[model samples]
Target chain A: MTSEAPTDLAIEVRGLVKRYRGGRGQDELSAVRGIDLGVRRGEVFGFLGPNGAGKTTTVRMLCTLLPITEGHATVAGVDVGRDPAEVRRRIGVALQEVGLDARQSGRELLELQCGLYRIADPAARSAELLRLVGLEDAADRLIGTYSGGMKRRLDLATALVHEPQVLFLDEPTTGLDPASRLTVWQEVRRINALGTTVFLTTQYLEEADQLCDRLAIIDDGTIVAQGTPDELKSELGSDVLTIGLDPVEHDRARDALLTLAGLDHVTDAAEGLAVYVDDAAGAVADVVRLLGDAGIRPGAIALSRPSLDDVFLASTGRRIEGGVPEMAS
Target chain B: MNETLLLARRAVREVWRIPAATIPALFIPVFFLVVNLGQVNRIFPPSTPFLHGQHYVAFQIPVSLVFAVSSATSGLAMVTDIDVGYLDKLLAAPIRRTAIVWGRLAADLARGIAVSMLVLAVGFAFGARVKSGLVGVLLLIALSAMWGVAYAGIAIAIALKTKNVQTTNASFIIFFPLLFLTPNFVPLDLLAGPLKAIARFNPVTYVITGLRDLVLFPDIHWGSLGACALTIALTGVALTALSLRALTRFSE
Candidate 1:
C-alpha cells in the first residue's frame, strides 16, 4: 500500500479493505479488514485462508474484479484502483471458478482469449498455449466435454495467452482428483519456472507449504500469519500434539493443558485441542495425565512436527478445517 | 470494436453449437403461425378487408416474425455465462465492459435475421406473398431482426440484474401480453373499443404494422415503416441503455 513500493515487487498492497453493503435492514459486512502484502517479482506467493476468510475478496480487489473499499494495491507496478487496465494487462487471472465456456472448444476459447488480448496471431498463440498446458489433444473438443483436469488446464492456458508478468490462480485444484491436483501443481511449478510471479490462494496447507515461496494465512477478514512455509512452521518452534475431545470440553481441555511443562500454547482444534510444545514425546504424557485428572477422556491423540495449520492455529486460536490436500476431493 | 466483435463471434458460435436454446424459441412461433392459420384462415379469408388483397397468412406473417425473433435466448445465454463464470473471464480481460453487452446484441442480430427468414419461409409455405416484393422481403427481415436486437435488451438487463436462469427465462413471458395487446387477430379499427385503444398505444403494433404493410401492399409504406423504425430505435436505446447499466453494475 506504500506509494514508494519497490519496483522489484510484482504486487504490493497496503491497508487493503473490502466491505459489502448489506441489503435492506441488514448491517454492512466487512469481508476483508486492512491487510498488507509484498509479493516479489518472480516467486510463487500464496494467499492462504479458509472459506469466507476474504482471500478471494482480496484477490478480486487486486485483480480489479471488485472495487477496493479502502486502501491501495499496485499490481505489476500499476495502482489497482487508479489504473486497473494496466494492471489487467500485466496480470492474468484464473479465478476459483474455472471461467471457461462450455460451448467453446479449448482451441476456440484460447483463440478468443488471444484476440481479446490483441495478440497478433491468435491461432499460433492458442496452439502454443495448448501445448504448454498439454491440452493439444483435447484442444478441439467442447469445453463441456472436457474432463475436470482438462478444463482446469485449458483455463490455465487461457490466462497464459498474453504471457502476463503475474498470474493469479485461486484454488486451482480445490475439486480436482489427487492425480489431477498433482498435475496442476506440476503445471504451476513449470509456469513459475518461466519467471512469472504466481499469486495463488488455497485452503490446502500442503499446497501452500509445497508450492508457495511465501504465504500469508488469512482468517475472518484478516491475515493472521505470513512467511515462508518453513519460516512460519519453524516459528511455531515446537511439535504439535492434537488431542481429540468433545467440543464442549475444549475449554476444560485447554485449562488442563495450560500448566503442562514446556507447553507453548493450546489452540482449539475442530475436534479438540491443538497443544504446541517443545517436546511432543515428553509432553504427551503430561497432556494425557492432565486431561485424565480433569475427569475428561481424550479421544485419538496424534503428535507431529509443526505445520502451516499449526501456524494458523497459533495465530488465530482455531485450526483450519480441511487444511490438508488429502481432504480436497 | 475488435473486442466486441471477438466476443460477438463467440456468442454467435454458441448460438449454433447449442441448438436446444434456439429450437424452442423457433418452434413456438411456427406452431402458433400454423395453428392460427389452420383455425382462422377460413374465418378471416383473403377477402377480409384487413387482408389488403393478400391472403390472411400474409397478414399474419409479421406476427410470427415478431414472435420468433423476440426471444429470451440472449438473456438466457447471459445468465448461463454468469452461472458458469465465463462472464468473469470476459470481465477480467482487458477489454471494454460495454463490449460484453454489445457482443450479446450482435449475436441477437444474427439470430434475429435467421429467425425472421424462417418465419418468412413458413409464411410463404402457407400461401402468403410479400406484395412489396424482394425489397419488402429484405425490409421485413431487417426490421424484424433489428426489433429482435432491440427487444433483447430487456432480457439481457434482466439476466444481468437477476443472474438467475428461471428469472431470466421468465422474461419471455413479459412479451406474451405485449404481443397480444397489438392487433394480431384483426385490424385495429375492428378490435373492441378497449382493446383497440390499448393496441393503438402498443409499440409492437407499429412493428407488426410496419412489417405487415410490406407484405400486403405493393409499395413501400414509408409512414408505417418510419413509425416501425422509430419504435425499434426508441425501444433499442432504452433497453440497450438499461442492459449496459446492468453490465456496469454487475461486478458490484
Candidate 2:
C-alpha cells in the first residue's frame, strides 16, 4: 500500500554465464552467455526474449534454483552461490509452469505455502492473498477445477503470501488467453505498486513495453539490447509509416517510397510497405503525392511510433517470435 | 528436526486429499493377508513345526507385514511432487533440501506402521498368536515398520532419478524377485536348489526369520534379530545417500 520507491538495489548480476550439457555426450549448451543485469528495489524490470533465449535460465540463477556455472550474481545483497538459502528466503518465484496441487483447494494450498515459509498467521495471510487475487469466492474449490487464468492468479497469490522483497515471474502469462493475460497484468501492476521489486520475463513484446520500467532483450543466451521501452524506441530516430497497397503495386510503392529524401529505409511486408522516415507527418504527404502521381494509390495508410517489436527486429534481424531456437526434446 | 517433522506432517495431510488412491493403498495388504491365509491354511499341514512349531497364519503374518511395509512406492509420491511442481517449490524454499526427503519418508513410515498394526490385528483375529505375548507383538510391529520405512528409500531414490510414474512403477520389479527369492514363501530349510543358496544371502530372509522367531517361537533369536537390525540400518544409509544424490541432480 505504500507509494515510496525503495532506495536500495534488490538484485545485481555481472557477466553471469550458465551452461548445460547439450547434444548427448557431455557437450556444453550455454543457455546464458555472460549477461549483465541489475534490478532496483520497487521497480518492475522485464527480461524480454523468445523461448530458450536464457530468460528463464537467468531467472533461475537469480532465484538460486540453478547453480551459476560462470560469472557472479547477488540477490538481496547475498551471493548466489555462497548464501543460496538466504537469497531464497528473501525472494518469491512463480515459474512459467503452474505447480499447483490439484487436490488442494486454493485456500488450502496457500495455507500450506504459508506453513512452508513459517509464517506466523498462515490462515489470515492465505485469506488476504486469496482476496488479493480475486479468488475469494473459489478459495475452497479444488485447484483442478480452476481455469488457466484463475490458476495463474492463484500462483501469483502464492508467491506473494510471504511478502518477499523480490518476486520473480518467468513468462507469467505465456499460455493464458488475452483476457486472462490482462487480468494477470493487472495483478502484476498491483504487486509492483506495493513496493515489491519485480523481475519479470515475458515473450509478449506489448506486455513488456507497457509494464516494464526498464527492459532487456536476450538472444542466443545473452542480452542483445537493454533500455527503457521508450528509450529503446527513441534510438530508431524516426516514426514508422506503413502503406497497404495492392500486391501488384508493391514494386512501384517501394520505388516511390525509397526515392523520397526524408525516408530512411523501406521494407516490404505482407500487408504492404513499411517505410521509416525522420518525420512521419512531413513524409506522409510527399509519399501519398508521389504514389498519386505514379497512379499507385495505396489501399490504406497508417503512421505510428516504433514499437518494441521494431526494436527487436532492428537488433536481432528477426522478430522475437521467429528467431527463437527450439530446445531438444 | 522441527522442519522435517513439519514437512512430514504436511505430507501426511496431502495423502488424505486423494481418497480414491488412499483407499486402494490401505486395502491391498489387508486383501493379501485374508486371501493368502485362507489358501495357506487349506494347503499346509496343521500345527507344523516348520520353524519352532509355528502355525501357518502366525508365520505368514510377519511376511504380510513386511510386504505391506515394502509395497508402498515413495517413488509414486516423488512423481506426484515432480508433476505438481511441489518438488521445485520445496527446493526453492528457505529450508534444508533434506527436509523434503525426510518429511516424505517420515510420513510413509507412519503410514507403513499404521498399516502393519492393522494387518497384525487382522492376523490376531484369524488365530495368529504371538508366543511372546503383547511385548513381543509390539517389538515385531516396530521392527517390521522400520524395515518398511527403510525400504522406501529405494523407492524415493528411483522416483527422484526417473521423475515419471511409469519408470518408478517399473522399479518395483526388483521387489517381486526379492520377495520370492528369499525364504518368504517357504521355510529357509525347505527352500531347495538356487533359491535356498540365495536365501542365505537375502537380507529379507533374516528379517522374516527374525520376525517369525519373535512372534511364533517362545524364545527370541537375538542373532537373527541383530542381523535384521543391521540390514535395516545399512539399507537406510545406502538408500538415503542414493535419494540425496538423485535430489541434487534433480535441481540441476
Cα RMSDs of all predictions? 3.9, 4.3
Model 1 per-residue lDDT tens digits across residues A13-127: 9999899999999999999999999999999999998899999999889999999999989998888888888788888999899999999899999999999999999999999
- What candidate 1 gets wrong by more than 4 Å, as runs, is A1-6, A242-260, A266-275, A281-303, A322-329
Model 2 chain A: which ten-residue window has the lowest total lDDT?
Answer: A320-329
Q: Over the stretch B1-252, how does candidate 1's per-residue lDDT look in tens digits?
A: 299998999999988888888889999989998899889988987788888777788988999999999999999999989888889888899999999999999999999998899889888988999999999999999999999999999999999999988898887999999999999988888999999999999999999999889999999989999999999999999999999999999888
Among all candidates shown, the one with the greatest lDDT: 1
lDDT of 2 by residue, A252-289 (tens): 77776667867767766547777878899888889988
- Per-model DockQ: 0.71, 0.59
* Candidate 2 backbone collisions, by pair: none
TM-score of chain A of each: 0.87, 0.91
TM-score of each: 0.92, 0.92
Off by over 4 Å in 2: A1-8, A247-252, A292-295, A322-329, B22-40, B51-54
Error of 2 at B235 (Å): 1.0
Find the 10 residues in a row with the least total lDDT in model 1 chain A: A320-329
